[model samples]
Target chain A: MTFTINAEISQFQGKLYKLSHESTSTKTPMDVNVFVPPSSNSKIPVLVYLSGLTCTPNNATEKSFLQYFATKYGFAVVFPDTSPRGAKIEGEDDSWDFGTGAGFYVDATTDPWSKNYNMYSYVHDELPKALAKEFLQLDFENISITGHSMGGFGALSGFLKNPGKYRSVSAFAPISNPSTCQWGEKNFTNYLGNNKEDWYKYDPTHLIADYKHENQPKILIHQGSKDGFYYKDHQLQPEIFVKAAEESGYKGGVDLRVAEGYDHSYFFISSFIEDHAKHHAKYLGLIE
Target chain B: MTFTINAEISQFQGKLYKLSHESTSTKTPMDVNVFVPPSSNSKIPVLVYLSGLTCTPNNATEKSFLQYFATKYGFAVVFPDTSPRGAKIEGEDDSWDFGTGAGFYVDATTDPWSKNYNMYSYVHDELPKALAKEFLQLDFENISITGHSMGGFGALSGFLKNPGKYRSVSAFAPISNPSTCQWGEKNFTNYLGNNKEDWYKYDPTHLIADYKHENQPKILIHQGSKDGFYYKDHQLQPEIFVKAAEESGYKGGVDLRVAEGYDHSYFFISSFIEDHAKHHAKYLGLIE
Candidate 1:
């Protein structure tokens, strides 16, 4: 891994590393921020955070209190960029929700996008291994995953696609049933190319019923009741995903929490970040 | 206070109100963010935070964890802009420091700047009264002040000049002796019109010596040892401020803590914000 350290910043009782590296998956330089807490006797657990649409690694790395909680829980956090930046595609910088800053965490099988939009392989497979090699004190096997909005969809899809890969998973106002949302449809049609089956494979709502695990771990999710994306535009259909989870063999696995008076912003994320951190901490065995 | 609520976002158990109002002090539409915690029997004490140069209310409001501490301590936090924005004078938006964001918290006496650069009066006087009217539950009498860098200078100058106005005061990497530093000298010269005597009035180190107070409250301050502004450029002369406080009979009143390995950013501020908030909470009788 040809990794370059952009800047190392201190926050809470930890150091946040702004890093970029050449990726084999996407064949482009990727930026990822990793925060490691003060060392302990045991190797620190890792929690990979995927950011929402129109966000970069710096958004969650700077705006949210993830570092504080990671330090408190004695864990490390990895903030990956929303998409492959500076890819130089023809119309990549057009829409806020589609091309730039919205990879949607799917391996694009379609033309043009297939070259640089391999975020699924980059995030789920390559990034973790690269981070582990750099930070020997990090326990990659005890890693968990979480995200917000578009990143939330990435987290849920990533967790379901590869069962037992992550110790646990959680999301904050994720696009639960993206197969049914307009935001998902535009990206899926262009990235996956007309195959509803290909979209179903990446959709958490549809994939939940097909995914098989011997011991189904509880999936924690927080959906804001006042989220405009969930209520007005219907961009997030968490209820449909919850119902699908119940219909699947993994009964009572999805723990959906509807938070009142919250929105789809970092304010909502920071508010319940303590709960999300604690949830991952329990599975990672950082807390009793 | 003709206040217009721009946006109200929820964080922790409180709502962060992004407000812009026609200012009686700056004579421009001023922006400020107020986060009021969940109400209790006791009226909430206010913590007015002054931001550094090149910052608006959103920089500190969105980046820092002041809202979390405020909710935890049951107090309200007011984040006022560094200066009156959109003044549109010649060279107002030229440099990142001198004119636009770097108000230096001084009531300007020079041409062009004097019309709108009245942050000293805006933050110290009119802001409090205006905020008090808008937020009825806030206990203005028990309010304390805090800031980062330039705002740090503001907190100290305001506290010293006004004497019994604020219950307590603290700073993070403040430009202590602004009459000496480059950032201070440039702003002071242009804003105060080459009048060294007038500049001393706004300089915290100089004001500490002449101001007469019945009881000197301990002013808490944290200066990062690794801060380039402090170590290399000598922009923040905290040690000079401490020595002046002692000579002026405020012995042991200025608690100057030089924190190791920290920088002059929100990273440093967020790490020690709990301590600053607690310091004010103690004076406000929130904790024993």
Candidate 2:
């Protein structure tokens, strides 16, 4: 078996399968959780959920409350781990923000990290292919992407870069303009080198500016007003992506909602998960 | 403030307040998380959730998906920690089954444990009083109690002993005949001494046998058939209580639904949470 079933838990009207498989991109075993709705038959649209920094497949799998929505909409939800596990690189486990659990969803171009920190290809390409091959019921073509924080940035940047690849994109408190953020600057400097151009390639704000939508490409985003990362540190500037979208061909396509009293946590994500699910369901043609 | 608000995150018309407070029962600062549902104007009913072994308050707070139901029903939910934390007893953290996270919800009568392991008093009395005094909007008088595994035993034992105290009681994969179960017998011997009578007092099977119904008390329980603890170890003898209920005045009052393909994890609890919430809501008079 290419994928190992670590645990299978029955939840809602579905079963949550915790799986691990050797990844060619990361060159290590990666853990991922896939929730298949109970009544799912034939081909079901996939909704890939990416987690934030200092998270694993379990964080969103346990916290996001996605299974209920998945079961309701008849879509398979996949939770991919944030980064490669047990890489053993120097200073990897030192900080909660930069290394280990914080992959930032970029294919690292620097040494040590470059060898195993290829979460971009792992999540964007390898994971979907692996899942499709393993589970024939999953429709990768009709997939939608959604995430929180760094994972949220992954969804936006991955969606913008690969046009028409995903049916829809949604995020919760995403690091919109990652190139300028402290988290991004440190991670980019370490993983993608000092080249600002490399960082721009992965920045959602930058990507949205050049993105040419076939129709007015609608991207949904819910940011918590009380998010410490957004308000205190000014790390997650969601308005930048909204502004970029306005200037681009996708003008007025972004639906950025600022949720009051919410924070940069799973509580905030779980609150708006149903709305995001509905948004993706509409785009995936699960709902009209 | 004796009770420090560690983090307050907004979710689904509610705010999850992670609080740590000085405990009079446990004699240790205890951590708790309370979910105050949105749009609550008048004093609303409360649901106190007790987690199982090797769990913190965050387990159910994150995974149980109770907040949605609480918000829907206009009720507040409180998730108390499994046990007194950081007690630092000699053999406290030695085993996953006892000590540390597994306080077993007992007011210990032995040795070092007796000093800090008074979880029964902490959860049933002090915690509720503290929460009621602290949050004006919470009506502890109208509170329902529910738990899973060891905490489920807590709910049954607590509810049975304190007649007319709670509006209702429910459990998921609870150790019904804990006095006979190894997990129960071991913890009982350690906490309540070697007296079998002392252990029986805390056992639901024994309690239900002698329980005097006030207008016919009803208790809802959902036990998973695939639960390893129930099948393999025989640690959770739910049938014993059901049999006892059949002989007692609480006959047909104990609704024990054996769910298929579900385990003893939060997944099982979350799967039936809506049903449990509705069950609680009916007794709490939040629903018709």
Candidate 3:
């Protein structure tokens, strides 16, 4: 069945389009929201934004700083739900870590979740195909992928694992060495089973250490100095990935920005969003 | 009783201070949200944003195209809720145009509302006083006011009545001749009684026609050509106010800009907000 999109304008000075679609791969319907640039022209570049754990499509659509950039660069933004929802299947009601809100942006192979939790294919394929059919101005060819925390891990793993899929990639305080972090350790162990190699494939730091992507895109990483979860003192060390980028000869070497007196909040994301937009805009050739 | 405030950071890249104030004037506590510029010093000029009908402090704080301007011009923004909430007093549950959500930015003189509907005093004096005590850097001496629809009316009426108060003023599709619009008629009749004389005191066009300020601050007006409420054919015309400003011999002339293909939504506000902030910044000496 086709999704009906509700069109409305926000006081934020942007167009809000809400649509729902049945995923062929996931076997479950998903809700998605897209914010197009203020421009009347429809063929604008797009940014695929993934959200973190305990978040749905509504989180980033309602809170992220991508719109201002989209409004400025005349780009469109597509936000997909973290996992398939509304089904009464088994294990869907489990803890917040490995269940509904945590699709891990990968195609699940196990039961219960495997029935509908194919977020990787949903975000990369189904939604884009639906968006292009509905909106005339969306440029799928110049799309970039980005997210925060778990979503950041998804973006890094998804982009590195499939090098030519996205124009560029970046994240804010993502689980860099996810295989080593507790949150990542728990999720990876469940989602991919006890396969350590499968875990490294989704780990950004591990990908950096191994080195992939002959045509590397600019990577912008923004981390708050005061972020309680992954500060320099915390278990989630971003520098290890920075070091990995240095040693592995990664293309478009990391531009790690340390924001002072900031934390792991949208305020931190919004503060440096313009820089990320500019980075993507430059690589996508949307702006000079 | 004192209101409690907690400082939280927004993903929009700014510091958010949530304020709850005991409105001594009304005996009912009020909740307001403020977003400050990315400046270390608090001595920045302030812009008091008044939202339209059916809105709260959260609307502008969450949506407005303010961050770009706030960051660029280094101005703090104070967003007060449209009206007082919680008490189930008489007429409080009236239509959407009056009572609870629609404070009209005026002090209700009649029954039921008079006790808690003192938005005029709250915005003009108490809110600023609270912000001043809490945020040290806000320069009240160099403050400006702006809004949308009813809030726009509030800005114009507030600035016009309190001449020499704001260095500048502007609005997005304001109800210029509110004395005749349906929204104004409904709000003013209930809040100000059936007396046209009382309504004139809150009407911008009427206020400007009665008394002119010598150093009239730069008044920037942006009205969409396709505004659903105030098109060229409608009663909510911007021309009447523009003509009144021109013929009334006001010192500071109005800068009326008609945006093509825009409406009364935030998309219109976001598109031109930076320009408005720049206008205020130039007069307040925040940016060269």
lDDT of 1 by residue, B178-260 (tens): 99989999999989988799999989999999868774788999999889999999999999999999889984389999988
Backbone clashes under 3 angstroms, per model? 0, 0, 12
- Stretches of candidate 3 exceeding 4 Å from the true structure: A1-3, A8-17, A35-44, A54-59, A90-101, A129-138, A194-196, A231-237, B1-3, B8-14, B38-43, B91-95, B225-227, B231-237
**Cα deviation of B278 in candidate 1 (Å)?**
1.2
How do the residues B82-105 of candidate 2 rate in per-residue lDDT, one tens digit apiece? Answer: 988888789999989999999999
lDDT of 1 at A230: 92
Look at candidate 1 and tell me the lDDT of residue B181: 89
**Descending-TM-score candidate ranking:** 1, 2, 3
The lDDT values for all models are 0.89, 0.90, 0.78
* Cα-based lDDT at residue B211, candidate 2: 77
| TM-score of structure candidate 3 | 0.88
lDDT of 1 at B68: 89
For model 3, the local distance difference test gives 0.78
